[model samples]
Target: MNDMEEDGRRTTMTTTKTRGIRLAKEENEKTDVRKYIPPLDGQYVEKWLNDSQNPGQVGEELVKQQFLLDLLHSKISARYERGLETAEIDEHAWQVQNSITAIKRRLKQLVDTVPPVVSLETTDSRCIEMYEEKQLMATQGMLRADILEERQRVARLCWQLHNTGEDTKEMVNEDPKNDEQEWVERCKLEEAARSALLEEINRLRSTCADLRARLEMEALSNEVPKYDSL
Candidate 1:
């Protein structure tokens, strides 16, 4: 009776161990299968391509796809070099290659569908010249308008300062100069204010001149055609 009990306990332990090992193995296989699945699918690629509007968008997509292809190629190369090629790696590589091929084909189709650009030489020279002249005139007119507006602002500032000086003078005349020292101080303050205003006006005038010179230079540069080597 004691021997039979010990044998039964041993059998139960063995069965439990086998079951645990089998469960672990199956879990690992499922993980491997998930790992081999392609990150992107045909539907995703088709949607991406369709959403792209211009060559720039397609170019960006191609860059991302190329990066993935290089990564997959590297993985496959590393596996083969290390004698570790497996069905999983091969399947992943195949799926990635298919994606890459599809991307390239769509890009080619986009390129083919785009219309050829009209050459500048094909356009009428007279029309081009007129267009350039119109652009130049427009820029010059803007500059002139800006300069006139700035001049008007300066004029208004000057008028305001002049009126303030006149008011100060009137106040000084209206108030009796009982204190000579105070009168002298008042005059000194007025002189200082006037000098500061004049300095500011000078600075503004210098800035205006500099801006005008720059605008003229820009206009000249635009007028001169930059010839390219034939």
Candidate 2:
């Protein structure tokens, strides 16, 4: 009985070893099918799918690979399109930034070359003084013109008075009843009026000359550079 029991135990061990070997061989075959089948050939999916009833793990792998390919074709393609759009936006932004830089440079050049126009809002007291001086000069010019016109009228009146005096003298010589003293008084008054007109004309001429000189000086000063050049 001891020998029979020992033989039985040996038989069970042999069967267990045989079963384990068979399972290990089957596992190695499945691993070889997954690893050695060239995925790059693009035919593994077709072969695995041809035998659907017995496809096993390889079939499930083909299904998962097909799903991944579809996802890449749909989602990744959309991602590529979005990347292209993003690149275009970045390029446009770069161009806009360059344009803005160019505009700023052009504005700086303009500012350097041209002076700003002065207005009533200018803070410079010189500008105010120059404006007031110009107004004064205009007024002086008008006054000078009026004075010249008046001088011309006065000279014409003086000539007429001299001619009338000569005519009255001839009439007085022809008529002895004419008052000689009254004629002399009228002649004296005419001379005084002529003298006054001559003095006024001379005074106006002096004032005009002075005003013209002052105007010239003011214009020269105005044309002078206000600030030092860089």
Candidate 3:
């Protein structure tokens, strides 16, 4: 009974080993079939077709060559069709890409050419204010000149009156105190007007300086680089 059991176990092990060896051999044979088959080539086909040494096998050779030629022609035709389709798809994709690029370029150009709406509005308003300030300054200058001319004229008139004949000098001396008081008051008023004008001019100069600083800041902000797309 012990010998029978050992023989049975040996038989089972041998059968499994043999089955595995058989399967491995079959797999190797399949691999060799794929590895040994020559790749199709037009030169090889032509050479085979041109051989005429075997007269008895001419008909079989001709049939085999014709089948190979048909298969090669079909493959070439299929490849050519696929190439044409791929080229068309590539061309369409290229055109789409170009259009997108052109659109982005145009948008960038517009962004560069067209100033910001808020900036434009602000610039126009500031320009108008500057013009008004210039006009005011001009008016102030004219008024200052006029006041100086009037003061000079009054001084000339006073000098001429003081240098008049004896009868005119005596008449002027009759109310000299009142005339002196009035002249002092007139000079004070003229000085006050000139001071006020100077103060206004200084204020306007400060305002212009502030405006210039703001404009420079805005220009610097605008100079920053902009992206073509997000």
Best by TM-score: 1
Off by over 4 Å in 3: 1-173, 224-230
> For each candidate, what is the lDDT?
0.64, 0.56, 0.55
Sequence-dependent TM-score of model 1: 0.31
Per-residue lDDT of candidate 3, residues 1-230 (tens digit): 99999999999999999999999999998874533333223334334434434433434433443454345434544554453333443344344334333433444454556654445556556556645644554554455455456556667867865675455655746777887898789779978987886788667656665565566555745754433322
RMSD of each: 24.7, 43.7, 37.5
Candidate order by decreasing TM-score: 1, 2, 3
What's the CA error at residue 190 for candidate 1, in Å?
A: 99
TM-score for each model: 0.31, 0.26, 0.24
lDDT of 2 by residue, 105-199 (tens): 44434444657554434535655565565555455455546655765676798899799878876663654545667778887998899789768
Please give the distance, in angstroms, between residue 230's alpha carbon in candidate 2 and its true position after superposition. 23
Q: Give Cα distance to truth, residue 48, candidate 1, Å.
A: 2.3
User: What lDDT tens digits, residue by residue, belong to model 1 across residues 22-116?
Assistant: 99999998874533333455448777776766776566666666567567656755664455645686576567666666776777677767664
Model 3 / residue 27 / CA error / Å:
89
Candidate 3 residue-pair clash tally:
0
Native-referenced Cα lDDT, model 2: 0.56
